[model samples]
Target: MKVRAITGFFFVIVMLGSVLLGPYVFSVFYLILTSFCLFEFYKLVREGGFKPSRESGLINGFLIFLFFAAQCYFPAWKFIFFLPVCLSAVYIQELYKKTPAPFSNLGFTFLGILLAVVPFLFFHAMAFMNGSENFNSHIPLGFLVMLWSNDTGAYLAGRAFGRTKLFERHSPKKTWEGFFGGVIISAVAGLIFSHYYTELTWQQWVTVAVLISCFGTLGDLVESMFKRSINVKDSGGILPGHGGLLDRFDGLLLAAPIVYAYLYFISN
Candidate 1:
């Protein structure tokens, strides 16, 4: 247990520090994250009684990821229009092949992109999400701090006084007590960083906090549902105590887009 704690702490510092560095560093983080997440997601699909072409899935998934990367690195709003094109390409390519009953090769391919590629884009989007003036100089770093506050509060409170379940059916590990604790912690963090993001009102900042805590949990549950459906303990072995890439970012996947949307719509 002590060893796990030490290892987990070190891992968090390195990962968070790299992520906090900047957009260029963040892009590299997302690429590696998307790649490993795709690998773990494919593992889940195979477990669910569908055998997809590993080479095809990885290739197609990475290509879709490239589209997202382009949108971020090059600033292409047309990339949003490209989603259907990419989805269709993946579907048609997979459906053409032979497979067994309930064998929707296209379905697995589509799911992979949705789960793996889509969320991966948000991290990049958040980094580069601002217009010229409204851009928070500390955007990526501030965003991650909000998320970490959520997790930290949830973990400490949950350990101290978590008993009732949050969503017992989907995720046995979550507790309602911890959920509320995370929300409170995130709100506090949002308030703290409210100055850095001068674009938002206190109310808007508070809303962001609530969304981060609540939707963050939703994202966690979504991944938990995926893991449960496939009967796996962790998504991968990339992070020490965090389990996998998916495990670490499960909450942030939904939270990132939301944080982006808040800035995009309200402030911009």
Candidate 2:
């Protein structure tokens, strides 16, 4: 517990710093994060007796991230044309390889990028959604705040009052009581954030909080499912006492994209 707490403390500092510091720092930090997560995904799949195109996938994934980031800050739509070309490289490169399951490799390669990289790009989109050219950290920062609150609430509540299992097959420790506790805590945090941020109304913030509670839990289960399939206990040992990057950010994976889509449709 001590080691986990120490690791989480510094990890929170870097994450908040990335947003609060500046856009350049935010961009660079997520770029490295996206790349690392993609690498980890490919590594995980490799353990499942499949070979994904690690090099091509990482390159294209980075390019795709740049594409979305460019759309947020730059004026050129022409750059998006390059995405197809990069994707094609993934397929074309498979032809020269000796693997019999080339298409399987191709599919997993794309899946890794889609699953790990694209959502983060949507997260980058959030920082600029308020129509200001400068990157505003409040929206993204509020998101992390609520996610952490939900996790903390769930942990405490589960330890104190957990009974019925939420998803025993995938994650046995999760409880319905804990889940609702997280929702209530995140909802309250969302209301508080709306008071200060003001970028979104309180109702919208609460809705975002609900989405995070439901979908973030799903994200965590999905990552656990992946590890279970591979018969591994943790995704990787990259973060001591915390499992891996995937283990830490699994909630953000599905939640960010879904939240971005929600905010996008409502704004439109």
Candidate 3:
């Protein structure tokens, strides 16, 4: 556990430093993480004796991640249109092949894709905005920082002060103390980013803080539900202490699009 902790700390720091540099840096990392996660998801599905089009999943997942990556560099909304089509096609094929219950497994899989893809879109959108204008380009980095901060606070507080369970049935180790700690800590991080990093006002920061606190928690829970449903402990073994790339990115998956949406609305 100690070794895992130490490794996780260093790995996180390096990833943060690299990701914040610009699109090239973050894009490379995002593609790699998504690939690992998609592979893990595919593996889990196959192990369940349900075969999803592995080719489509990999191609679709990679295309989705790369599209967001390019969204940072380009402004084409056309690619975004293909996401649902591609994913739905994957689900439809699966349904026709072995034919699961009406919209049961297929719906589950499609929903999973939405949950996974949209935030990544936001992450990329931030980069594009950053390049196009300097008014709030830092929002992308700020959003990611808060995500890391959320996890850090939750883990530390949960270990130090946690007593009461938050959702004992869904997740055994999660405590209410950790939940509040993550909220407070992420809120603070959001405030600091808005105050010092971006030109956004206090009101904006407060809004961002709330979104991060709420949506980020939802993202984490979503991943947990997937794991629990599949009777798996970790999403993958890619990361040591983190369990998998998906495990580490569970919150960011949701938070990224949310923060982007807030910024987009504000920008417009």
Candidate 4:
């Protein structure tokens, strides 16, 4: 428990620092983070008796992140033309590997980028969602707060009064009670964020919170399903109690994109 607590403390510190330190640090930090998560995903896919193009996948994934990150500054459509070129490399590389499951390798490699890398792109975009060239930390910071609130509330509430299983097949321990508990707590966090951050209205923040809590749970379940399919307990032991980067940021996978879309829609 002590080790877990200590690890979690540093984790929170690093995450908070990354966001608050301005756009350069945030972009650099999450860019590296996106790569790590993609690498981990490919590793897991390999463990599941498949060969994914780890090297090419990582390179292409890095490019994809850069493509999105560059948009915040440049906002040019021509920057996107490179993406197809990078993706084609994955297919061409697989052709020479002589793997029996070449298509499976191709599929999982792309899946790694889609599942692990794309969400962070949306997450990174949140810092510049207001159509400003400058970075605004409020939306990203508030999103993290609500995300943590949901996780903490669900864990506590589920332990205390959990009865009916939420999804017994994928995650046996999750409960419906925990889900609602997370939503309520996240909503409160959103309400609180509205007071401090005027980027979004109170109602909008609350809506963001609700979107995060619900989809965040779905993200967890989806990762749980992936782990079960791979027959692993955790993604990796990179963090003492938290598992891997993938495990830590799994909620962001689904929640970030949805929340980004919502924010973008209302902002525009």
TM-score of each: 0.84, 0.96, 0.82, 0.98
The regions of model 3 sitting more than 4 angstroms off are 75-109, 130-137
Candidate 1 C-alpha lDDT tens digits along 1-268: 7766887788778767666676566667677778788787777778777765556667767766676666554666665675566546555655666676334655676677677777767656665655422323365666667778888898888888999998999988789899899999988888877776665666777788888888889999998888887788888777666687788788877887777777778745
Encode model 3's per-residue lDDT on 118-191: one tens digit a residue: 56666666766645433233666677777777777888999999999877777888888998898888888877
RMSD to the true structure for each prediction, in A, is 3.0, 1.2, 3.2, 1.0
Worst 10 residues of 1 by lDDT: 128-137
Candidate that would win on TM-score: 4
**lDDT of all the models against the reference?**
0.73, 0.90, 0.72, 0.93
Clashing pairs in 2: none
| Candidate 3: residue 52 Cα off by (Å) | 1.7
Best by lDDT: 4
Residue 6, model 1: Cα distance from true site in angstroms: 3.4
Segments of candidate 1 deviating more than 4 angstroms: 72-96, 132-137, 196-199
Q: Considering summed lDDT, which 10 consecutive residues are worst modelled in model 2? A: 67-76
Question: Which is superior by TM-score, 1 or 2?
Answer: 2
Alpha carbon deviation, residue 46, candidate 1 (Å): 1.1
